[model samples]
Target chain A: MSVKHALLALLEQEPMYGYQLRAEFEQRTGTTWPLNVGQVYTTLSRLERDGLAQGGGEDTEGHVIYRITDAGRDEVATWFTTPVARTQPPRDELAIKLALAVTVPGVDVATVIQQQRSATMAALQDYTRLKRQATGTARAELAWSLVLDSLVFAAEAEVRWLDHCEARLRRAAAELDVQNSRLTDGTSSVKREFRRSTGETHADRTRR
Target chain B: MTAVLQLTDVVRVHGEAPHEVQALRGVSFAAYAGELVAVMGPSGSGKSTLLTIAGGLDQPTSGAVTVEGVDLARLGQPERARMRRTSIGYVFQGFNLIPALTAAENVALPRELDGVAPRQARAEARQALEEVGIPHLADRFPDDMSGGQQQRVAIARAVVAERRLILADEPTGALDTETGEEILRLLRARCDAGAAGVLVTHEARHAAWADRVVFLRDGVVVDETGADRAETLTEPAAR
Candidate 1:
């Protein structure tokens, strides 16, 4: 859906051949979201069928040049003004995996967290390195840098969440131990003591 | 590649038996010349402890700490103090600039103490100020400058006399986002110029400036993403 919209938006700029449009898209986005030339042609055909684009003219190289119609311009304007719908969020495999890891017995949750953290951290580093190499201040470079920055921030959040998960797990294990000891001792006094000592809730600790 | 700062299986314990806390437990780390390494962890994860020991501000309870091949554990207090002045530079989150001294004077103080002539130290300070992009503020006192400018002065002081190993502990904590980025840029530039840098920070955005990241947990290294991995990263497709 986005690729179609993105191609439409790019077409709003000027008439372009399939390869040229693909190149422009990749250049602006630093190839982070590479587009196949075939996909570009397919989207262009759909736009033509919808009366939003016309592709009758041929370039010197025999490449069909697709131009946006007035209808296409209107569609692009609507796309710009409208916010992306988030009612049905995309599936996040990492979050799902983490949820499962915590619930499933015999799973080394700490190791899972650590491994994911390292991989995400490595991804963060890669993004940083790419950002460093993208030193140009041109509009295209700015677009690429912003894309890389988004990736870097997302990876950082994932790492921080992993750390928080580890700490929460540790706290839960400690509380479980206290509860187990209380059960063995057959006394309610230790529960009172534990609560008094750890009077601070997770919210309080997070605030700190 | 020679490590400008190396910590070999270092351990540090605070206080005696009953109330003692192990701050660093057998943690080995190295920051090579021309490389910036960021240390990240939750609070009380020995991030600061590792930095202090690396800077020779605090001694490791056991194991070796070598700065430019000089074993800190074998040195006397006076010699180690001299090493801190000559080889290691520390930048704290607070900026820690002396209010009475001008920017150049604050930077020159360490060099002057190390027995550099007054005029020469002053000249070196000016050069360092220029390096941190604050040459025009050389005569301004800490009280007169903005927090960002004061932090620039703090960085100038750290890199003055070409200290081989620069240690920063949340150096941008007091500044705004843009200023923090400028400070990180300065630090990254210093490391790129062949000075080894160890940055202790919790913010991964800040750590992204480093060539590698070392994550600490419970006084031990839990994970590391090294520069080698960074180097092999695939570049974006050609424009």
Candidate 2:
């Protein structure tokens, strides 16, 4: 998410050309977040404009290398020590979909939740398989495994949320049934009505 | 590689007429040697029904289930029971170890039941306990061991006779997260050691250890995906 800081941190190691920087970033991150060479060059130019990095003279091979400036080193140090801000969480499309599905009419909310749950489950499985395959002792493997685990945790959370949504919807429907029966009978026996109609308690409904 | 277990258009129904519950509706599946396939679904989605039919503990109302190329429904009840003891291994959530039996005896029970000599059965059981990384627990009774240790003993029982097909239903339902992971690792190891395994689980994390995942809903196969393509299936669509 913080490509600028990541590039700065990488530059602190040694001077690198655009291609070399991209390759090194990918190697360390296990290609989980691939860096385009063009993106690297563009960032390098911006760092030069901001005086955070300076381009050294071309080598004998005609490749221009960039080195971190004092400003870039200080920025990288701050980035490492500072906690990542959560005040403005990134927009999650699944969260948005579920939120809208509950309020939107004729949306078939159950189907929406089920589809998203299936997708998230598939992704979780993929992450676990990748984790198993990444058994190398290299530092890159460790980094990649950590990244994959975060994704797995996120997907697992999404699936659990979907299940919660389904249970909530079922409860809402059961409550609506109780409200209807109460209005007809002029009796406030919501629990008894729910049981009479569904032949099961709220706990049974949620367990199903 | 050949499939150690195959279900072809299997259909199972409980009760009759208006009260009939169609537990599995024309579901087909296969688990190959050296592969772990996970079956996942909500409750009443036929996961347990599928497992029971595959293990030949129950018969299908329609279609066929084959283990090692032999149709299960074709065999008599006694023959099917024998096949279950010799070719199929089942693990349940309860650990299911006999209270009076030691870990090694529990693991060796299946072999001994199949008329195998007691000494040979005990030797196989010790080897299995060693494979599960708990040989020292062989002499300990189930009550003396931890939940994880008991599960390991159950796994040893499952794989003791070199059974090619292992069916597990919520095998880690009773253990903590770390212990559940250890159990999954053991199941994965068994599959890697050239056995076919089918794991029925509600948790996606448990299903993640599988090579292929099959999703069931309303007693029908809804989706199937290989582990590598899971990301593409879950990725958000273009806004």
Best by TM-score: 1
Q: Every model's DockQ, to 2 decimals?
A: 0.48, 0.37
Q: After superposing candidate 1 on the true structure, give the runs of residues whose Cα lies further than 4 Å from its correct spot.
A: A185-208, B227-239
Task: Note each model's CA RMSD in angstroms.
Answer: 6.8, 7.5
Angstrom error of the Cα, residue B88, model 1: value is: 0.9
Candidate 2 lands at a TM-score of 0.77
Tell me the whole-model lDDT of each prediction, alpha carbons only.
0.89, 0.88
Best by DockQ: 1
Q: What TM-score, computed on C-alpha atoms, does each candidate reach?
A: 0.91, 0.77
CA lDDT, candidate 1, residue A164: 88
Per-residue lDDT of candidate 1, residues A1-208 (tens digit): 4987888899998999899999888888877888888898998899999999999879778999999999999999999999999999789998899899999999999999988877887788788778878889999888888888888878889888888899999999999999899889675996567857989565774788
Identify the CAPRI category of the predicted complex in candidate 1.
acceptable
